[model samples]
Target: MITKWEVLSLIWASGVAYTAPRILNRWSLITTCDPIELCQGCRDERRYVMQEGMTYEVMGAAGGPLQVLVEAFAWYLKPFLPALRRAAGRPPLPTCSKGSCLAHTSTRRRA
Candidate 1:
């Protein structure tokens, strides 16, 4: 029952209905290509101020006198601890190859 002009009009209307929203919703449709230039002055300065304050607090706590002294003492004693342990006749540290690997491999083979 449709005539030629009516069919062409219907096709044009359907095409517009399908593509209009997609064109409108595109990222470039609503936003500027030079976004950084537009937004450069809109950033919140409070966040930067708070971050600097927290950095100063953390640095003060980590480098306090007692912390510095403890770190220095540990560094000084690092080389002597192994020799002292041997002289005390404590058993040498356990080897992972002897204990962990043997147990896991034995269980896997049995299974």
Candidate 2:
């Protein structure tokens, strides 16, 4: 016989099991960037991180994992996104430049 407590515990565990990895996968986007100063690379990473959250929130367990996987895979090809867009007949986004701006410094860094 299944007691009420056991049923509740199963539900709670299931929720945690589903959410825990999604949360960690989303957090993987955090890279080198000071809390106050976000480099262009930081901005892109953060944007993708937020997209992960939104994707999971909207898609739920059904589609979220696959969509997030696609997104994560896309991050590996960041250098090619500009060319991909250009080939698609879209104007390049301004942040596609080779060097990332760190804070307000004259030195532009990162790929």
Candidate 3:
């Protein structure tokens, strides 16, 4: 009942189905890779570290006014880092539509 020809045909069909869209899609190359790391928590931690470093440079006055402004913005983003860590199951840098970041404020207080 199970012939090599049938098995080969099935495998070839599945392969085509799986890869067809990738090959046929006009904008296949337009899709961009995510900058954030694999885990959401790890990505958040990275963001926090970068922000903290920027803030330190700004406070130390090592950079100009524009740099200071950018640093200040980085600092302002700190409070949302924990939430980003929690929402890691989703995209590495998920959009803040679910207010997951607000939930994290309380979680951070406990830790």
Residue pairs with clashing backbones, model 2: none
Candidate maximizing TM-score: 2
Angstrom error at residue 109, model 1: 48
- Highest lDDT model number: 2
- Clash pairs of candidate 1? none
Q: For candidate 3, lDDT tens digit of each residue in 1-111?
A: 999999977776665555444332311211121323223443454465446556666556653344434434344345787677677755444432223343233334545
The predictions' CA RMSDs to the true structure, in order, are 31.9, 12.4, 19.2
Please, what is the whole-model Cα lDDT of each candidate in the order they appear? 0.42, 0.55, 0.44
Model 1, poorest ten-residue lDDT window? 37-46
Off by over 4 Å in 2: 1-35, 59-64, 72-80, 89-111
Model 2 over residues 1-111: C-alpha lDDT tens digits?
A: 999999977776666566556544434424334533565555675677666667667666756566545544434356798889999999766442324444323223211
TM-score of every candidate: 0.27, 0.38, 0.24
Alpha carbon lDDT of residue 89, candidate 3? 56
Worst lDDT window (10 residues) for model 3? Answer: 24-33
Q: How far out, in Å, is residue 37 in model 2?
A: 2.5
Q: After superposition, how far is residue 29 of candidate 1 from its true place, in Å?
A: 6.0
Considering TM-score, which of the candidate structures 1 and 2 is the better prediction for this target?
Answer: 2
